[model samples]
Target: MVKFNVTRKETSPIDGQKPGTSGLRKKVKVFKQPNYLQNFVQSTFNALTPEKVKGATLVVSGDGRYYSKDAIQIIIKMAAANGVRRVWVGQHGLLSTPAVSAVIRERVGADGSKATGAFILTASHNPGGPHEDFGIKYNMENGGPAPEGITDKIFENTKTIKEYLVAEDLPDVDISTIGVTSFGGAEGQFDVDVFDSASDYVKLMKSIFDFESIKKLLSSPKFTFCYDALHGVAGAYAKRIFVEELGAPESSLLNCVPKEDFGGGHPDPNLTYAKELVARMGLGKTPSQDEPPEFGAAADGDADRNMVLGKRFFVTPSDSVAIIAANAVESIPYFSSGLKGVARFDIVLLRSMPTSAALDVVAKHLNLKFFEVPTGWKFFGNLMDAGLCSVCGEESFGTGSDHIREKDGIWAVLAWLSILAYKNKENLNGDQLVTVEDIVRKHWETYGRHYYTRYDYENVDAGAAKELMAHLVKLQSSIPDVNKLVKEIHSDVSNVASADEFEYKDPVDGSISKHQGIRYLFEDGSRLVS
Candidate 1:
């Protein structure tokens, strides 16, 4: 047996290591700095409970971004040195954020070990390359991003971190293969296991949805489908699930090959970023010679965000979740009789503060528990852990349920497909199938519609942005002043009935998150947030 020695390398804290809701993200050059990644990784291990590190299993993988291979090797060595009994890596160092979560929760090692945490490396929807962005975030045993309490500890540890542990003599394990490599160490034995990236996630998906029904819908001549992975990590699973398992035509997949640079395009699954998919769906600037498919979808870099589309139509994320929540009980079998045996009217739905009130309307009509949480997914994770939320989404193209703690892009696509299958169960051979647009229109007709739009001002000076937020908060002191300002902007605009800085109190944890954003409630059901 080969033996490896651990070395404690002396290091100093680097400035600007603070992590946001997603973890540390920066340009590849920034992460390439000496000890930069090491510092953050060490800080994360320090923030976790000692039991979670020593003699525990951890998974390390991410979207096949530019530096992901190197990051995976580094994290493996670090995990071994930190006394982690085993480290799991997805084959070829590829795993979507949601896949990592699923692996952590569902995958068992050959040695019968379960992962307690994971280091997910990807900048999500952000662009990636040598000069673009890179990121590393830690997920807990529950398969969710670390809560604020743990992240706060990580940031503090990063500030004062003086050293990191690594097994410098440990040869890099080949992450391209699916097998286990073991080594003897001072603590006992450290192992690195490389496994298939999609099996666990696919198995989970199969259990939640009726693939035969979705496959039947796909096989129907009247129901055409197209999916674009945007050359991101979603491509890794798209072929297995959508094509091999669900029986979609091979040609229906676009950019189904994962690329480190996302094929030199931004991997955000929106109308602007997913240009090729939009064009194929008949929503682009130039029309195609052939008719568009009945349904289309795209995924971001890490496959945690999704955009749903129909022929020449886009489904807003806010409306997507509401429609899913409204129909989940009937369409998805898991919602009707899985997990907590969730039933109609027993479902709980949630939306981020910035998301429109579309989901709230569904909740009211169904008499389901509803909550408006801050933008972070951790808030929803808390509710799901407490069995308080069954479905949740954000306006930023994220959607999921208690099936997994993290938002799941492919799962969202599968869910929409399930709904379509259920709606057309008896009509697959009819002259025309029920389209995505039809379902959305029916939802609006039943629950009324809420129009939502957002404008972003990026790269603003920090001080100016702070001042602007302060100004918005300050105006909330006087409702009349806000109303007057609204009227001044546009006489036809509705008057502001009330205003306040958004604050959320976690029902499960009783943690208060203040100043999530500034919101103005209108006389009608409309709302404006900043």
Candidate 2:
């Protein structure tokens, strides 16, 4: 018989558990310390308040990376001891970041229950294994990351947390199968439900996109497509949506199996890390011989980040969101009501010194309202929650819309596919299909192109990185001198109109965030900065 008595284990507070922009990510060994994961989880529960967590349905899942299975069992036991009514988990503890958000928003239980919050286990694009990175972040009922207030409260709770409650003796529930595991607990009956990870997200994608149109494009011999999941949980959804639902050939999918260590390769979907994808797209150092696929894409470890390619060309993340926004009303069925919904979904945008001004150009041309915010995707979520922006993205391969609270990797891929299909609908079987490069080139010719590039000297001397950041700050006082030097260097370069540190005040929450980054604005809508 399973012992379900709650255990009140006294424990000392642990230090350095604060969450960053994404979540509380640390080395796996750092997370393996006694009472580390428990204290943080309990602190998050406390931050949500005892009433909210008690008798509430919570979702727990991740990318099936190392230690995620064990973490899920531990969290399940803790939830039972804390009087949680029911916990929903993906099969085998596998769920992408966006899928977790989809479950919170749409998944319904056997008795019409909906998830109130979630503990998303992932280190995002970071490498994962027993010796690699792992992380956990809490999401609210709104299907968004816990707002800054909640995260701050959780951090504060962690500092003074005296004890954690857990049903330590509860037998580990089997998560490999889709079924409900029941246990009699002191508070009441507790349940753990393991469900298919891809169903809810696949439903959401189907609702938003026209799968028939995409299938037509995929079946066309002229329009070859490839998708690399980087061995993350995305493979579950990609196989379900891309191959099963959309009728793409299984051979077109690569690395579509989840691995504990991401097949010993960095799972980030960038030109630097997604080597197999780059090679298949004919962009690697040793390029492929066969003609590259007409379209190719890759997703990060958790599948909330994406990199899109056209043969050897790459589509910048910022442009991907803007292109999606521009074509959504026509290509995607969900936006068919002309984006003038209960709340008008207009514009694609981001803030100061954008990596690419292409989205700003689209917003300006469409007469959509634009905004500048601090350097964090959460701020974009805030803006979207207020109905201020419809689509947003970062230069670092993240893109999404107000459709879901989080950046979605698969959604971006679908958007690109929709654009491709729409552009060549009449010519699906023709010898020539409009390609990704053509779509991007056409967008540039019409909207005006802005050269975009980013340089990151990462994993460098920590002290030197700090010194470099400080130097950039110090240069603010000499803006005029910098402009003069720029003028001396090249007449084609624009003069610096202003230089300052970026700060933001959230109109929705009245919260202040400062020093997002330094920007050097030019006289002709150009920017050069750190």
Candidate 3:
């Protein structure tokens, strides 16, 4: 072991250090500024209770984005100086956002210690490079993003931070290898444990899913599949799970190599960004020469968001969640028997407010508890922790369950595969297979379809965006005026029924979150939000 001493360095707060619900995101150049990352890291340490920091095991890793390697080393040294007991890192400093959450909640150290928290470093689905985006967020022990209370405190500390501690003599551990490197520090032994990136998460997934059934489905001659990691960290597990475990053909995987810059392509999983997968799935501008696979899926940079496709057909996130919930009892073994022993109304479903009412219809049909929260995973996280939610999703292609706090991209794919397997269990050897399109059509027929579409405008001038939002909110004050304007714009649209800024009051902690979004509801059940 190498001996090290903690050094307290003087510093000052930097502007724009506030973190959003996902975390602080900025260009790699901005994060590379001297003391910028340190200020935020220290502020986060200061925000936590002393016991949660001292002698606590923490996991630190993320999607293999540019500048992540350097950031990992800095955080390791700081963790040592801060008296953290151990830092668990995935091999090569790579771990999906959801994998980090699983590690926090499931991974046990060599000494039988479990992680208390994690610093998840990734800009989610954003592009990454030296000039592109980089990000950092903290997750708590429950494998969920920190609640607003902690994030608010972290923001407050960032504005007034005066100094930060670092173990300057601590050598950077070789994260490429799976082993533990220990350092003798003033506080005692500080260890950096580099482990395989996928084992713990795979174990968790195996526990929740019937891998044998999925393997049988993958082995079927009638079914063909494709998975694109989009060059994100999801690649780290795709081969291990899809090909090695579930027996998907190696040829079925696309862009499975982890690239720091995502191969110069946007890493979002939507049809707009997942061009390669879209083309292969025969949904792009150019049709595929070869027959498209029966099922295709893509994961975003951090592997928390998923876009699932069926040949040339697309499944909206709203329909995806509803379909999963409607069939979960028989499809996925984890959700068998109404999930966590809850029957009927005790089983919970959730969706973001912007999402269509597909899941609502399913919840009513299944007699399950349901909720519409704001467009943040934290809201879903709170409900999941309270055992009030089993499945939740957002219109932005994010989906997950109580299995993990973070939205799990690969898990969503596996869930789909599980459903496929359950549906075609008897048709595996037969030439006629139950196709994804067939299942989706059947779901729509049973639950009634809710057509949905979304448009996103990026890089708008902040002032103009704020003014537009203000105008929309002001328009909501007068439903009749809004209806008149709507009629003048489009005469066929229904009259406005009501409008308001969405608000949420947490059932568990009784915390209030206001102004989540602006909504305009029509008598025809159509809704618009900004």
Candidate 4:
């Protein structure tokens, strides 16, 4: 009999385990403590009402990072204990963030047992290893992360969870096998089905994209591209989509195998962490050993973030979203299939405040509806659900739309390919080529660029950070005034139109976060001090 051993409960050592901009993240050591994962999992189960838990269909998967497999097993046991009837887990515990979202939307419906939600094990672009960080996030029925209200309830329950229930003894089932594994004392009763992680997602992508056109672009003699998977979960998807489906040579992909620890490399697709891809794009020799490939791309762990580069040029995520929205009709088949004919509203776009204003120009030219929300994808969920927005993005290398609740890294890459195909169709070729860098330059030329940079101060004493923010707030409120010794310089030159700590209230639910971040907006185009 598989019985859960009772463990001593200590005062919750994780007071600040609240989810971050994406999800709850902390060092591996922190989550490895006995009953740490259990408390959180139980709290998650508690967040769901009895009706939401009993006989519910749940989706489960992870990024294949350190402790992912172990976490999946524990969650399976807990879900069964919580009276969940069926669970759709990724084969071998491998599913990218976007893939999980795709599964929830495709599998969860009225006819079948609606997918109550999902529990994804990932720390996103954060480093993964024995010593690095790990995380867990719960997505709601809408395939988006649990809103602030739900997360706060989970945190509150964690503080006092005395025990967690589980099946007495169940046979370990094969995760790769696509069949049911019985649980509980009754024979052939509660069960779980291990599903292929990439099948449904690939099918959806095929429906939305013109794979034949992309295949032609991939096979073109004039085009040469490289896709680096960073040894993350996307390796399988990339191999299937880029190699098997698109007919690209197997060698076109680098790091095309999933590893538990990402092979000692930080699986983040950025200039700092994805230096290998950057170096290859800048210096790798072509088939002639004299010229480099024309394009290169990379996706982060969980495959929800992408970085695009062309030869020696880098494309910012803000610019990427704008360009894709502008070319959506030509590149993506979903938008092109007369859907625009009915609505005719220029691609609706939304972005976080800190993101570059490049999209404003595209929105103005195309007469599209544009919105600026706080720095989190959850804020876009309301607009998308209300049918007011179709495309949205964040400056942190994230982009997605109503297609999926989370950012779709491979989708974005394919979107770029479609745009390239459209550019090739047009004969308006000039010195201003259709490269990743060209997209930014064109956007800047049209809409004066907003010089943007973020300074991240990590692990600062929480009290000190709070105090500093309070001082800034006081200064902003008392305009044109200063302390006895200190004089206010440039007061009139830079009028602080607004200065306050940021808070986000969920439109769907009235949950509120008092202090998300600090902001000081200036009248001049430039703003400072976060």
Candidate 2: segments with Cα more than 4 A from true spot: 1-3, 338-354, 484-492
Candidate 2 lDDT by residue in tens digits, 1-530: 24489999998889998988777998899889999999999999888876668889999999888989989999999999889999999999999998998899898999998999999999999999989999999988867788788899999999999999999889999999999989888778899999998899999998889999999999887888899999998898988999999899999999989999999888999889888888988998995998999999999999999999998999887778777767777888777774665334354356433446777778788777777765556788787777676777777788887777888999999999998999999998787889899988888888877777887675699899889788878877897888778879997898888888877888888998877788888998877667
Ranking by TM-score: 3, 1, 2, 4
lDDT of 2 at 257: 96
Q: What are the per-residue Cα lDDT tens digits for candidate 3 across 1-530?
A: 79999999999989998889799999999999999999999999999999889999999999989999999999999999999999999999999999998898888887999999999999999999988999999999899998999999999999999999999988889999999998998779988999999999999999989999999999988799999999999999999999999999999999999999999999999889999888988998988998989999999999999999998999888888888888888888887765555465678899999999999999998778889998878899998888899999999999999998999999999999999999999889987888889999999899899999999998889999999999999888888899999999989999999999999998888999999999999999989988
State the lDDT of candidate 4 residue by residue for 416-496, as single tens digits.
888776666543233333665665576678766666665567569999987987887777665445322132554345565
Candidates 1 and 4 compared by TM-score, better number: 1
TM-score of candidate 3 on Cα atoms, chains taken together: 0.99
Clashing pairs in 4: 1-169, 2-168, 2-169
Put down candidate 1 lDDT per residue, 1-530, tens digits, no spaces. 67999999999999998888898999999999999999999999999999999999998999999999998888988998999999888999999999998998898877688999999999999988899999999999999999999999999999999999999999989888899899999999998889999999999999999999999999998989999999999999999999999889999999989999999999999988899999999998988888999999999999999999999999999999999999988899888773244455556899999999999999999788899999988899998888788999999999999989999999999999999999999999998889999999999999998898877676689999999889988888988888888889999998888888888999887899987888888998688888
Per-prediction CA RMSD (Å):
1.4, 2.0, 1.1, 4.0
Per-model TM-score on C-alpha atoms: 0.98, 0.95, 0.99, 0.89
Q: Kindly give the stretch of ten consecutive residues in candidate 2 with the minimal lDDT sum.
A: 342-351
Worst lDDT 10-window in candidate 1 = 338-347
Off by over 4 Å in 1: 338-345
**Residue pairs with backbone overlap in model 1:** none
lDDT of each: 0.92, 0.86, 0.92, 0.76
Is 3 or 4 the stronger prediction by lDDT? Answer: 3
